[model samples]
Target: MAKRGSRRAAAETQRRRQTSGRRGQERTGWRLWLRRAVLWGGALALLGALFLGLAVAFAARSLPSYGALKATQPGQTIVVRARDGTAIVELGPSPGKWLDSEQIPEVMKDAMISVEDRRYFSHPGVDPIGLARAVYVWVTGERRLQATSTITQQLARNLFLNSNRSLDRKLREGILALALEAKFSKQQILELYLNKVYFGGGAYGIDSASRKFFSHDATELSTAEAAIIAGLVKAPSRFSPTADVDAAVDRANVVLGLMREQGRISASEAAVDPSAVKLKKDVSQNSVRYFTDWALPQLEILLPETFEPIEVWTTLDVGMQQAAATAIKGNVPRGAQGALVSLDRDGAVLAMVGGTDYVATNYNRATDALRQPGSAWKLFVFLAALEAGYTPEDRVKDVPVTIDGWSPRNSGGSYAGEIDVRTAFAYSKNTVAAQLGNEVGFGTVASMARRFGITTPISTYPAMVLGSSETRVIDMTRAFAAVSAGGNSVEPYGIVKVTTTAGDVLYQHEGRNPTRLVPDYVAAGMTDLLQTAVSTGTGRAGQISRPVAGKTGTTSSNKDGWFLGFSSGITTGVWMGRDDAKAVPGLQGGTAPARAFAAYMRYAVKDRPVEEFQTDLQLPEWQLEPDDEYYYGGDPDEYYYVDESGNLVEPQRPGPGQSPQDPFPADGEQPPAYPAPRQPQYPDESGQAASDDFLDRATGARPSPAPVPAPSPRTRTLTPPPQPQQTAAPRPF
Candidate 1:
C-alpha cells in the first residue's frame, strides 16, 4: 500500500511540472509579440510627424512676410468727388479709413461672428471637429450641413491667398491662419477682417459701408444696419442695400435670426423692423459710377503715375444724375436698356446714366456702344444743306427714289409730293432726306458730320441720309452742344480739378478757347428747324416747360430709339435699345426716348435761367428750280417723273457714251432703270423685317451703282467755287 501511494504521488508531481512549463512558454511568446508591436507603433508615429512638418513648411513658404501683414497702407487710393464736394466713388485698394478694434461697434462684431463663424472664438485656427463634419458631409452628400470656414481662416485667405478651390490653396490657408493666430490676438484678427472685407458699391471696410448705405459713421450704426453690413460678407453685390434694399433686408433678417440663436442678441432686439432701416437717399442712385468710371481713366491720363492718393473733383451734378437715372429706369421697357448723357454748353459732362441698373451691367453705353442713330443722323444732312446756302424753306420732292436699286421708303409707305426742308426734317421724311442727300453730295455731308465731333466711321451710302450710320450717344450729344453754344466747338470733359489728398493741385481744367464749327447764321437756321421739330412734329414728346429743341430717331424694326435734345444750355441724349440689337415692337424714339428726355430736362433746367434759341437769321431766300433737261415739263405740281406703275422715278443720268434716253445704263450703273419699283416694304404686325435696313444697299445682294462720272469737262464752268476748308480743332469732351 505504501509503494503504490509513492508511485501515484510521483506521477501527480510530474503532471504538475509539465503543466507549469507550458504556462511559462505561453507568457514568453506574448511578451515577444508586445515588444514587436511597440517598435512598429513608434516608427509609424515618427513618420507621421515628419510628414506633417514638411507639409506645414511648404505651405508657410507661400505666405506673405510678417511685415506685409502688419502694414496698414492701401497702395494708391483715388477718391472721386462730385462738384458739390460729396464723395461719389473710390477706386483702388482699401479705399476707406480702417477702423481699429475699439472703433468697431460691438454689434457689428457680434453680427459678423454669428453669421460667418459661430465658433469663431472657440476654435484654435483649425477645428478638427468641424473638419471632420465637413469631410463626412462631402462623402455622404449631406447638403443640409455647409462646410464652415472660421474667421481666422477667412482673414488668411483674404490677406495672403488667391480665391482658388484647390487642396494646395486650402492647406496654405489653414497654415497661414494658424500662423496669424500665433502672431496676433483674437481681437486684432477680428478688427483686421472687419477693415478688409468688401461691401460692394465701391465700399470697402465697415466704415465705408456704413457711410455709403446709411450716410453715417460706423460708430452710429443701428443693430439692423450692422446686420445688413454683416450679411454682405458672403456676397457683397448680391445683398448690397444700394443694389436691392428688399433683398438686403431679407438677408439682414437671416443674420438677425443667426445672432439670436447664438445668444448674441435678445429676441426683442432681433425683432427690429426692416422698415426702420432707411438707406441714404442717394444710395439707390449708384448709376453715377458709370460717369466716375469714364472720368477715372481721363484723370489718370492727365496726371503722372504715382502711389500718392488723389481727390478728383468732377463736373457731375448729383441732382441731375439722379433725375436722369430715374427717368431712364422709369421709362425703359423690360428686357431693354437705356443710356443718357448730359453736357453743358462748354461740354462738361453733368450727368451720365449708362444703363437702368449699374449693378446689372457696367458697360458704359453712352461712351462705348455704337448704334444706328436713325433720323437723329439727319442733323448732319440738314447742316450740310444749310452750309450749302439752302434755307429751311427750300422745297424738295418727297418721292420714292432708288439709288443702285436700293429703295428707301417713308415710314408709312406714303409720300408728300412737295415739302419744305423744315417740314421734311420735322416729319423725319425718309424720301425727302434721300433726295437731299443725292443733291448735296455724301462727301460734303460726311465732312459736316466730322466738323460737329462725330468720330465714328460714317458710310457715304445713299441710305445713310435716313440715319442708317452707327454713332455713339456722347458723340451725338457733343455735336448738338455745338449748336447750343452758338456754333462753337464743344469738347466733353468730366474732371474739373485733380488734387492730392493734401490739397496740392495736380491738374485743373481751364476753359479752352472756342473754335467756330459753323457760322452763327447756319446754326440759327438749324436751330429753327430743330425747334420746329420739337414744337410741331415727331419730337413733340420731348417738349418741356421752357423752350427746348431736339430730334427723335427710330431705326427699322425698332432696334434702337434715340432723342438728342438741348434745353437752357444743357444738351442731353437718351438712347433705348437692346444690346443684341433685337427688334422691340411699338418702340420709337418719339415715345419712350422722348419722354425720358423731357422727364430729365424738367429737373436739369429748373435751376437754370430760361434761354431761347436764336431763330431769326439774315439769309438769302432759296428758290427751287426744276431741271427741264431731266423732267418732262408741265404744271409745277406735275414736275415729278413717275414710272408706268405710278411709282415716282429717279432721273436717269447720262452714262459713258450713252445719252439720257438709253433704256439701260453701263454694266452696273443705276439698277436696270427701277426693275420693279422695289414693292415698298412695310413693317408687319411684329415690326420685324428680313431686310437689313442699315446696310441693305451696301450688301452685295444687289449690284452697286457706278460712281457718277466726273463732271463733264464742258460743264466745269457751271460749277460754283469750292468752299474754304474748315478748321480741325481737338475735340473738347
Candidate 2:
C-alpha cells in the first residue's frame, strides 16, 4: 500500500508540473501580445495628434494677427436727423455710444449668458459637454446643425470671422475663441460682445438699441427690456420690436424663463407683461424710415463720398409725420395701402408716409410707386386751358364726345350740359375735360404738367385728360405746391444740409432759384376751380377749419383713390390703393382718401396761421342753380353750401345783377351774370360710340357719392343733393 501511494504522488507531482508549465507559457504569450497592442495604439494616437496639430496650424495661419484682430473698423455711419435735430435713424454699421462693463446692467449680462451660454464662464472657450451634445443632435437629425458656440466663441466670430458653418470655419472659430480668452478677461470680452453685436434696425450696440427702442439710455433698462435686447442677439431682424413687437416680446419671455431656470432671477421676476414693453414714439413710427431711406440716396449726390460720419438735416417735420401716419392708419382700409406727402409752399418735404407699415414693406409708394392720377390730372388740363385764355366764367359743353376712338363720360354717368368752366371742373366732368384737351391740344396739357414739376412721363392720349398717365404722389404733391407758391415752380427737396459730425458743412441747399411756371392770374383761376371742388363739389370731404383747394381722383374700377389738396401754406397729397392695382371694394377718392387728407391737414395746419388762397380772378359762383324737376324737397330759401366741417350754411342773397364777387378781380370788373340752369341729360344713344377703353379699364360702375354726415346743431339743416341716377353708359373715371 505504501509503494502504490508513492507511485501516485510521483504521477500527481509530474501532472502538476506539466499544468504549471502550460499556464506559464500562456501568461508569457499574453504579455507579448499586450506589448505589441500597446505600441500600435500609441502610434495611432500620435498620428491623430499630428493630424489635429496640423489642422490647428492650418486654421491659425489665415487668422488675423492679434493686434490686427483687435483693431476692428466699423463701416460708414450716416445719421439722419429731422429738421428739429431729432435723430430719425442711423444707417450703416454705427458702433453706438460704447458702454463700459460698469455701465452694462447685470440683468442684461445674466439674461444673455443664461440664454446663450449656461457654461460660459466655466468653459475655457468651448464647452465639451455642449459640443458633444450638439454633434449628437446634428448627427441624429434632431436639428439643423445646432450651434453650441460659447459667448467667447461668439465674440471671436463677431470680431474676426465670417458666419460660415463649414468644419474649417468651425476650427478657425474655435482657435480664435481660445485666443480671445487668452487675450481678454471675461468682463472685457462680454463688454466687447455687447457693444459689437448687431441689435438690428441699424443699431450696433446695447446703448444704441436701448435709445432706439426705449427712448432711454442703456443704464435705465428694466429687467424686461434687458431680456428683450439680449434675445435680439440671436435674430435681430426677426425679433426687432419695431418690426414685430409681439415676436420680440415672446422671445424676451423665453429669455426671462431661461433666466429664472438658471437661478439668475425668481419665477415672479420672469413673468413679464408684454404691454409694459412700449417702443419709443418715434421708433414706433417706422414710416419715418421711408423718408430716411429716400434721403440716403440723395446724400450721395449732396456730398462727396467719404468714410467720415455724416449728419443729414432733413426737412421732415416729426409732428407732421406723426399726423400723416396717424391719418393713414386710421383711415386706410384693410387689404389696401396708403401714402401721403406734405410739402411747404417752397417745396420742403414736411411729412411723408410711404405705406401702411414700413417694416412689412420698404417700398416707398410716395416716391417710387407710379399710379394713375385719375381726375387729379385735370389740374394740368384746366391750368393749360386758363393759360390758353379760357376764364373760370367761360362755358363748356358736357356733351358726349369721341376723340381718337376714345369716348369719355362723367363718373355720374349723366352730364349737366352747357355748364360754366368752373362748374365743369368742380364736378369733374370728363366730357368737358376731353373737349378742353382736344381744344388746347394734348401737347399743351403735357407741357403744363411738366411745367408744374411732374417728372414722370406724360402720355398725350385723349384719355390723359382724365389723368390716365401714371404719376407719383411726390410729383403730384409738388405740382400742387407750385400753385400754392403763387405759380412758382417747386422742386421737392428733403435735405436742408449735410454736415460731418464735427459740424463742418458738406452741403447746403442755397443755390437753387425758383422759376415761375405760370402767371399768377392762371394760378388764381385754377385755385378758384379747386376751391369750388372742395367747398361744394366732390372733394367736400377734404375741407378743414381753413379754406382748402383740392381735387378728388378715383381710378377705373376704383383701383386707386387720390386726394391732392393745399391748405394753410402746406400742400399734401393722399393716395389709397392696392400694391397689385386690384380694386378696393367700396373705395373712392371722395371717401377714405379725402377724409385722410382732411384728418392730416387738420393737425398739420393747427399751429400755423390760417391763410386764404389768392382768388383775384373773376371767378363764377360755385352754386349750381337747382333744376326744378330734380329738386326734391325743402324750401328754396334754404339753398346751402357745405362749410369746412361739411355742415350746410346759408349764403346771403345778392341784389338783382349784383352777384358775389372777389374784392380784387383781375380785370377790375364785375364777374359775368349767372348762366341759365340746365337739366341733367344722359349720353345721346345715337351718338357714335367709341370703345370706352384706357389705361386701367373702367368697370363702368357708377361710384357712390361722398357720404354727408348729419348736420351739426348750430348749422342750418338743409336737404342734401339728390343722388345721381345711374345710366347704362360706361362711367368714364
Candidate 3:
C-alpha cells in the first residue's frame, strides 16, 4: 500500500509538478506577450515624436529670415508742392499720409476689426477657426470661397507678397503673419495694417481713405465714415465712391451691420441711411497740370526707385506763372502762337508759358521750340566785337557789299552814311553788322555764344551773325540771364530741393558760385547799348517804367519773331511764330515780340522793388604803339594799321585776274597762326578781372588788322526800293 501510495504519490506528485510547470509556462508566456506589446507601443510613440520634430525643423527652415521680416516697407506717394508748401500735384500710385494708431479714430479701428477680423486682438496673426469655417463653406456651398487672412496677413501681402490664390502663397502668407505677430505687438500690427491698407482712387491708409471718401482727416471721421472706409479694403476699385456711389453705399451698409452685430457701434449709428452719407467729390484732376507735367520727369530722375512719398519743393512761382500765361494769351494774335520764359538772376524759373492754352496743345514750346532768333542773336556778335578791342562808339561804314557771292541789303535801301557802332546796332542795320562780323572772327562770336549758355551749334557763315541759326527759347532766356547776372554763366534749372515726407533730403540743388564769362566792363558797355535800343531804338516797344534793356529779332520772311530783355531783378524772353515756320504779314520783332516782352515784364516786376543794373562806366584807355614785327609775322605790307583817327584804311586793290588778298580774315573764322583772344575764365562776385585779363589789363602789343578800307563820307544814294519781306534787322543792336 505504501509503495502503491508512494508510486501513486510519485505519479500524483509528478502530475502535480507537471501541472504546476504548465501553469508556470502559461504565466511566463503571458508576461512575454505583455512585454512585447509595451515595447511596440513605446517604439511607435518614439517614431511619431521624431517625425514631428523633423517636420518642425523643415518648416522653420522654409520661413523668411528675421532680417527679411524686418525689412517690410510700403510704397509712398510723391507730393510736389509750391514754395509755400501748397500742394501742387501728387505723383506715384499711392497718395496718402502715414497715420499712427493714435491718429486713427477708435470708430475706425472698431469698424475695421469688426469687419476684417473679429478675433484680431486675440488670435496669433492667423485665425484657425475662421480658416476652418472658410474651408467648410468652400466645400459645402455652391459659390467659391476664400480663406480668412488676418489683418497681419493682409499687411504682409500688401508689403512683401503678390496676391495669388495658391497653397504655396497661402502658406507663405500664414508664415509671414505668424512671424509678424511674433515680432510686433497687437497695437503695432494694427497701426501698420491701418497705414498700409489700400483704398480706392489710388489712396492707401485709413487717413487717405477718409480724406478721399469724406474729404476730412481720419481723426475727424464719424462712425458712418469709418464704416465706409473699412468696407473699401476688400475690393478698393469695386467699392470706390468715385466709380459707383450706390455700390459703395451698399458696401458701407454691410460694414455697419457687421459693426452693429459685433457690438462695435450703437443701433442708431448702424441705422443711419447709407444714401444720406455725404460723399466727397473727387478732386483727382491736378490744378497745376502744366507745372506738374514739366516737373514729373525731373522727379523721376532724382529718385529712380522711390518706394515712399516724397516732398519736392520746386522753384515755381505760381503768381508769376499765371501772369505770364495771361500775358502770352492776351497779347498773342489769334492765328500766331507765342512762348515766354521768365527767370530770376539766380536762374530760378519764375514763370513759363509753353503755349496759349495747355489744353489746346500739350507741346511745350518754351523749352522745345527751335526757331531762328534773328537779331536777338546779335548780343553774341557785339560781345565778340567788344573782345576784339572795338568800342561801341567806334564808326563803321554801312554800304551794300557782296562776299562769297551773297549780297545782303538793308531794309531802307539807303545808307546811314558812316554810322557809329551803337547807332548801327540800334537801327538793326544788316550791312554794317555783316562788315563787323567779317572784321571780328566768327569763331570768336560762336565762342561767346557758347559762354553765354547757348548750346545750339553755331555756323561759321557770316549769315549766322544775323541770327540765322535756330535755338530754343529757354536757351536764349538762359543766355540773357547770364548777362543779367553780371556775366556769370547760368544753367536754367527748375527743381530746388527734393525730400521724403520724413524730412530726409534725397536731392538738393547746390548752386555753383557765379562764374564770369565776360569782363564787367564788357557787360556794362553792352548793357548801356542795349538800354539805348530799348529806350529809343528798334526795341522801343520793350520799354517799361523802370530802366530796361533788350534786343529785338525778326527772322527771314518774318517766320520767327523774338525779344530778349532783362531788368536788375529778372530776365525774360518772348517768341512768336507759326509751328510750320510760315511768314506772317506785317510781323516785326519790334512790333509783336517787343510788345509781348514788355507786357510780361510789366506784371512780373510789379511787386519787386526796382533794382539797377551794375555798371562800371570807366572806359578802357587806348594805347597803340606800332610794331613792324607782327605776332603773325606773315606779309608786313598785308597788315593794315589803325591811325590815330581810329580809321581802318584799306590797302591797294589787287590787279585783275589776281584774287584780292585779305590782310586779316573777312569771315568770322579765326586764323590758326594768330591765337584768338581769350575770354573770362571765371566770374568774381565783385566783377573783378579774373583769369587771363587780356581785355581788362593792357598789353604793349597793338592790334594789327589786315588792310581794310576806311568808311567814305560820300556814297551813291539809291532810289526808293520795293518793300522786301519783313526780316530780322540787318543790324542787331
Candidate 4:
C-alpha cells in the first residue's frame, strides 16, 4: 500500500510542469507580433510624409495656362532689309512662319524624337524609366550622365520653368509636364515645341532654321538637313552650320545613328551624306552684317523700344558694300587692318567695311576706331585761315618755327622756305601749318574743325595742326561730306524709312533740309584746295575716273594711314593701321589707303553720272601768291611789337581767362618795318631787350580793301574740272 502512493505523486508532478511550459510559449508569441506591428506602422508614416510633401510642393505653384500663352506672343523680329528690298538680316529672333504638324517633315520629327526623347509618344509627360535610370546612375556612378527629361518635360521646362536642377524644380517640372500632356495631344505638343525652340544664329523655329541653315522650308528639309537642325537643339550656337560647319556635321551624324538605333529609320535611310546637304551661304556673311550692325543702334531713334515686327528700309547699297569690302580686303597689306566707310552727301551710309573678316571679329573699326588725323587735319587749318581773310596764295614760310620754346620741323627736316598756302597744302608741309596755326590763334583752328563736324577733342598745342588730335573715320567722313554737299552740315543717317508690319510709317528720313555750315566762297576755296591735293599733292593716287577731291594723312612712325576724299555723289574714308598702335613699316597714306580709296570710289561711282563740285566764288590770283600776312594774322586794332633790330612782331594770344595789355607804345614812337624773319622766333620775355617792346608798325597802314559781295544761295556755278596730268609721286617725307 505505501509503494503505490509514491508512484501516483510523481505522475502528478510531471503533469503540472507540462502545463506551466505551455503558458510561457503563449507570452513569447504575443511579444513577437506586437514588435512587428510597431515597425510596419513607422514605415507607413514615413512614406505618407514623403507623399504629402510632394503633393504640397506641386500644389503651391500655378502652372502656365494655355490662355496666358495666347496672350503673350513672342517678341516681334526687326527685319533689316537692303535698299533694294532684299532681306538682309533678322534682328530680334527667328521670324519663321508657324507650320502645323502636317507641314513638318517626317524625317525631322524622327530625328528630334530619336535624339531628344525616344519614348516621346508613349511617355505621360515625364518618363518614369528614364528618371529611374538617371537617379540610379547619379547615386552609384561618378558622373550624372543619364538624360531624364522627356520631350513633353523639356517643352514644359522651356516654356514654364527655369532650367534649375534642384529637387523642388524637378518635381515641379514633372508635375507641369503632366498638366501639359493632359491638356494637349502629342501632335499639338510636338508642333508647339518645333515652332518655339531655338536653333542658333538668332533663329527661333524649325522653318526659320531650315531657311537659315539649308536655305529652304522645314518640309523641304532632306534627311541630313533634318538631322543638322535636330542636333542644334542640344546647343544651338555650338552646332550651328554657319558658326561651325564641321561640328554641326558631326553632331548631325550622331543624330542619324540615334535614329537608326531607335528603329525610326532603316540602316539605308540613315546613310545620308552630310556633305551633300550643302549649307546655304549665310546671307549675313555676304557683307550684310556690316550694314545691319551699323543700323542696329538707329532702331532706338527710329521706333519705340517695344518689340513689334517692323521693317527697316536702310540706305545700304549692297553693290557698293561688296565693292568696299573687296577693295579693303584686296589692298590692305597682310597683318595690317583696314576700314572703309562711304556715305551720300546727306550722310546716308552707303557702304561700310569695318575689317577683313566680320565673322572673325565683330569689332567695327570704321565707326569705333579713334586715330590721329595726321596732316589730313591741315584741311581745317587752312579753312580757318580762309575764313579769317587769308587767301590760299598768301605765303607762309616753310622755315622752322618756334612757339613758346616748342619748335616744329618739316617732314624731312628740310625747309621749303617761303611758299604759298596752295603749294604748302599740296605737299602737306608741317612747318607752314604750324606758322599758320600761330597766326590765327590755335583756338580758332579748333573752332573751324568743330564747325566742319569733327566731334573729337582738339588740343590747342601747335602740334595739333599736324593732325595730332584723335578722331574717328565716320566723324571725319561726315565732315568731308560737308565739302561734298557744298558746305551743308550733314548729320549721318542710316535708316531711310521704318514701317510696321501693319504698313504704318513710323519714321521716315525723307531728306535733310539744306543747313549751310560755311559760306559759299569758303566752300569754293576749300574745293579748290582739295582739288589741288588730288591733282598734284599727297592724295594724287586717290583720284578716280571723274573729278575727286580729298586729303592724305600719316601719323608718326607709320602708326596710322588715312585717305579721306569725295567724288560728286559720295564721300569715303579709308584708314589702315595696326590695332596695337605699333608701326607698320613702309606704310603711308598715299600708298595702301589711296589705293583702297581709289578702288572703292571707282566702283561706287560707276552708275552715277559725272558731276562737278558746285562753287560760285573765284579763287583770287593773289590768294595763291606767297605773302607774309599768312603767318601773322592779328586784330587790326591790336598793337605790333618792335624788336631791337627794328622788326615788327605779333604777340602770342593769351591763354583762356587772361586779359591783354594796352596797345599804345610808351614812347609814342612809330612802329618798325613789316615782313619780319621768315622763321618765327619765340624768345623768352626775360631774355629779350627793352627795345623789343615797342609798338611801331601801326604808322605803315595801307588803304582798306574793297568789301566783297555777299554770296547768293541760288547762284551755283560748276567750275571746269582741272585737266589730269601725270600723278605726282608721294614724297617719303
Choose the strongest candidate by TM-score: 4
Q: Residue 16 lDDT in model 3?
A: 94
lDDT of each: 0.77, 0.78, 0.72, 0.75
TM-score of the candidate numbered 4?
0.62
Scored against the true structure, residue 29 in model 2 reaches a CA lDDT of 100
The better-scoring model by lDDT among 1 and 4 is: 1
Q: State how far residue 44 of model 2 sits from its true place (Å).
A: 36
Candidate 3 TM-score, C-alpha based: 0.54
> Mind giving the per-residue lDDT tens digits that candidate 1 earns over 117-206?
888888878777788898898789866544577888988887777788878888777877877766668998898888877787667689
Cα lDDT tens digits for candidate 2, 94-204: 556878899999998898899889988998777888989888899999887766789888877777777988988887788777666665678878888888778887787
TM per candidate: 0.58, 0.58, 0.54, 0.62
Candidate 2 segments whose C-alpha is farther than 4 A from its true place: 1-68, 71-73, 90-199, 205-285, 618-733
lDDT of 4 by residue, 1-733 (tens): 6888888888899888888788888887898899888899989998976885565445434544554643345456788877898877777676488878898989989999999999899987888788888778889886775556888878777677778778788777777777777777898889888887878777777998988877778879889898999999999867777767788889999999999999999999889888678777865665568667778787787677766789988989888888899999998877889898898877889998888886655578888888887878887888776665555555556655465455666666676666677778888887667667776668778888998888878898767788888998988888888878878888887888989889898888877587887666678778878878889998888988788888999988888899999986799999998888888887789989999999999999988899887644654332322222222333444445565685566557667998755333356533222222132353443333222112223333342222234321110000111121221112222
Badly placed stretches (over 4 Å) of model 4 are 1-74, 90-199, 205-281, 305-308, 614-733
Clashing pairs in 2: none
* Best-to-worst TM-score order: 4, 2, 1, 3
Candidate 4: worst-modelled 10 consecutive residues by lDDT: 712-721
